[model samples]
Target: MSHTVVIKDIRNVTHDVKRIRLEKPSGYSFTPGQATEVAVDRDGWRDEKRPFTFTSLESDSVLEFIIKIYPDHDGVTEQIGQLTEGDSLIIGDPWGTIEYKEEGVFLAGGAGVTPFIAILRDLHNKGEIGNNQLIFSNKTEEDIILKNEFESILGSQFINVITREEPAGDHVFLDGEIGKDFLKSQINDFGQAFYVCGPDAFNESIMDALKELGADPEALVFEE
Candidate 1:
C-alpha cells in the first residue's frame, strides 16, 4: 500500500546527509529497523523510488528518515535532498526483516546505521540498550552520522572508527578488510547474532568476517 506523507522539517546532519521529518498518516504503524520505498513527484524522476530506513522511535507519532545524498546517484535520494518543507511524497508501507534482537552487536558502516537508529532509540526508551553494543565505521570523522545522538543514547558502548582523519581509534581498512582480531575484540560472543548493514562490499566483508570468527551462518542478518 502507498501513503502520502508531508515533509514537516528538514535538517542537515552532515555535508551529504539530511534528516527529514514527515507527518505520519493515520493508522500507520512501523517497527524499529524497518524501511519504506519513497517516491517524490519531480520532473524526469517521478518514477524513481528508493528504500529508506526509518530513524524515528516506534512510539513517535511522526516519521523520520536519515538520508545520505550523493549528487552523482540518479535516484530518489538526490531528489529528496532537494525537497523542502510542505512537500509531499509517496511512500510504501514499512518493510524489512532487520529487527533488533534482545542483545547483539550492531555493526554499521556509513549510512547503514539509519535503521539501527530507531532500534537503539526504542531500546533506550525501554532501558534495553545497555545490553547491546554498536560499532560504526566511516571514512572520516565528518562522515559519522548521528554521532552526538548515538553517543547520548549508547554512551561509551558506541565505538566510532574514522579511517581517514586519524588512526588513534579503532580504524580498519575497508569493510571487507576488517580483521578477525578486531572483530573478536569488539564482539564478546561469536554465538550472538550479528546485524550488519552497509554498501554491498561492506556487508559481504563483514558477513565473511563473522563466519571466519566462528559465527553460525544462520545467525547473521544483513540488510537486503
Candidate 2:
C-alpha cells in the first residue's frame, strides 16, 4: 500500500545530509528499523522511486527520514535535494528485515546509520539501550550523522571510527582495513547478533571480518 505525505519540515544534519519530517498518514505503523520507498512528484524523476530508512522513533505520529543527497548520483537522491517544505511525496509501506534484538552490535558506515538511529532512539526511550553496542564509521569527524544523539544514547557503548581523522581519546581513527582485532576490542561478544549496514564494500568487509572472528552466519543481519 502507498500513502501521500506532506513534507512538514527539513533540517540539514550534514553538508550532504538532510533530515526530512513527513506528516504521517492516519493509522500508519512501522517497526523501528523498517524502510519505505518514496516517490516525489509523480513525473519529476527518471526512476521515480528510492528507498529510505526511517530515522524517527516508531511511537512518533510523524515520519522522519535521514537522506544523503549525492549530487553525483543519477537518481532520486539528487532530486530529493531539490524538495522543500509543503511538497508532497508518495511513500510505500514500511518494510525491512532489520529487527532490533535484545543483545547485539550495530555496525554502520556513513548514511547507513539511519535505520539504527530509530532503533537506538526507541531503546533509549525505553531504557533498554544497555544491551547493545554501536560501532559507527565515517571518513571524517564532520561526516558522522546524529553524533550528539548517538553519544547521548550510547555513552561509552558507542565507538566512532573516523578513518581520516587523528586518533582521539582511547579510540584510533585509522585507514586501510578493519579487522577482527578491532572488532574484538570494541564488541563484548561474538556470540551476539551482528547488524551491519553501509556501502557494498564496507558491508562485505565487515561481514567477512565478523565471520573470521567466529560470528555465526545465522546471527548476522544486513540489507539485501
Candidate 3:
C-alpha cells in the first residue's frame, strides 16, 4: 500500500539537490539507508514512482529525502525540482539492502550519498561512528552534498574526490577514477566492510577494485 504525504518543508541542498521534509504518517517507520518508491501526488504524475533513500533517522519526527534533480531530463526529477511546500507525494513501503553492517569505509558517488546520510547520522548520534570513513566523489565542489555535516561527523576520515575540476579551499582532488592503487594507498585493512553506492558503472568498478585489493566479497555492502 502507499500513503500520501504532504511536504512540510523543502530547500536546496546542493546546486541540483533538494532536501525535502514530509509529514510522517502515524506508525510510519524506516531504517537508516532504506528507501521507498515515491511519486508526485498530482494528476498525470502519480504513477511516476522512483526510489529515494530516507535521509532522516527513524526517531525523527518527519521523513526526509535528499533528492538530486536533473532539469534536462524532463522527467520525474525535473518535476520534483518544481515542487514547493505543501505539495504532496505518494510513498510506498521502505526497502533497501544498503543498511550499515559495521564500521568501515563508505564510498559514494554524487547523489548516491543519500543512503549513507542517515546511516552515518545514526552512528554519530549513538557515539558509534568509530573509525568509519567516507570517500565521496563528485564532479565538482558544488556537487558535494552536506559537506560541512560530513566533515563534522567524520573529520579527516571524510575524504572528498573532485573529478571534473580542481576544488578551491584545499579539498583533496583525485587525478583519475578510484582504482586499486588509490584503495591500497588509503586503506590499511581490506577485511573491513566497504559500503558503496553510485550509478551502475561506478558500483561495478568500485566493487571490482575492492575485490582485486583483497576485500572480501561478502563484506562489500551496496544496493544490489
Better of 2 and 3 by TM-score: 3
**Local distance difference test values of all predictions, in order:** 0.83, 0.85, 0.92
Off by over 4 Å in 2: 167-171
Q: Which whole-number lDDT from 0 to 100 does residue 135 have in model 1?
A: 89
**Which window of 10 residues has the lowest lDDT sum in candidate 2?**
168-177
Sorting all predicted structures by TM-score, with the top scorer first, yields 3, 2, 1
The model with the greater TM-score, 1 or 3, is: 3
Candidate ranking (lDDT, best to worst): 3, 2, 1
Write one digit per residue (lDDT tens) for candidate 2, span 60-152: 978999999988986687778888999878898989857886579999989988889888899899888876888988887778898888888
lDDT of 3 at 167: 89
In the range 17-43, model 1's lDDT, one tens digit per residue, is 999999998888889889998889666
Comparing 1 and 2 on lDDT, the stronger one:
2
Worst 10-residue lDDT window, candidate 1: 168-177
Q: lDDT of candidate 2 vs native?
A: 0.85
Report lDDT (Cα) of residue 202, candidate 2: 90
Per-model tally of clashing residue pairs: 0, 0, 0
